[model samples]
Target: MSHLRIVRDEPPKRRERRPHVNHVLTHAEQAQARAALKGLRNAFGSWSALAAAMDVRITTLMAAARGAYNVSAALLVRASRASGLSIGDLLGKPIAADRCRACGQIKRRVA
Candidate 1:
C-alpha cells in the first residue's frame, strides 16, 4: 500500500466583531418592527414600490423600520392607505371589530 498523503485544512477565520451601536433598538423592538414590516410587505409588495406609489422616499420608511426615525400617526395612516392596510395592521396592533370605523362595514386587510 502506498503511503497516505496527509493534508490538514486550515481553520476558518473568525469574523471581526464590531461594537454594538447604541442607536439600535432592543430585540423586542426589532421583533415588533419586523412584524410591522411583514404586514406592510404583505399589503404593498415591497417598500420601494409602496414608497413610489405614496410619493415618499423608501429610505424614510426604512429608517422608521430600523428605529432610526419616528413616523407620526398621520403619516402612518397615509402609509396604511398607500399600502392597502390599516394603521392598526401596519403597527401590528389588532383592531377590536375588524370592521370599518367609517361606515361600519365588514372589511378585510386591504379592502
Candidate 2:
C-alpha cells in the first residue's frame, strides 16, 4: 500500500498598513482638486506636459483629474507649485485674511 500525502495551501498574508500614506478627500475637496488639475493642464497645454512639470507619472495626473483615486498631499504640493495655487485652494480651504499669500504665515499685529 502506497502512503498518500496531503497538500495544504498557505494562508494569504495581510498587507502592511502605512500611516499617513493615502489621504481620502471629501467630495468638495475632490471637486476642488479636479478643478485645480484642469487649470494646470490648461496652463501646461497637455496632461503629459503638466505631469512632466510636476515630476509625476502621466497616469497619476490622469487618475487624479478623473477622481479615480485619492489625491496625495505631495501631488497637491506639486500642483500648487506648478500652478501658483495655494494648497488651501486645492483642498478647498479658504485662505485666511491674516495669512500671507506668498508664505501662508499669519501677520503679527504691532503694539
Question: Which parts of model 2 are misplaced by more than 4 Å?
Answer: 1-21, 92-111
Clash pairs, candidate 1, are none
lDDT of 2 by residue, 19-87 (tens): 654646676887777777876686678999999989999998999888887777788889988867678
Worst 10 residues of 2 by lDDT: 92-101
Q: Score each candidate by Cα lDDT.
A: 0.60, 0.77
RMSD of candidates 1 onward, in order = 12.1, 9.8
Clashes of 1: 0
Backbone collisions counted per model: 0, 0
> Candidate 1 — what's its lDDT?
0.60
Q: Could you estimate the TM-score for every candidate?
A: 0.45, 0.60
lDDT of 2 at 89: 66
Q: What TM-score quantifies how close candidate 2 is to the native fold?
A: 0.60
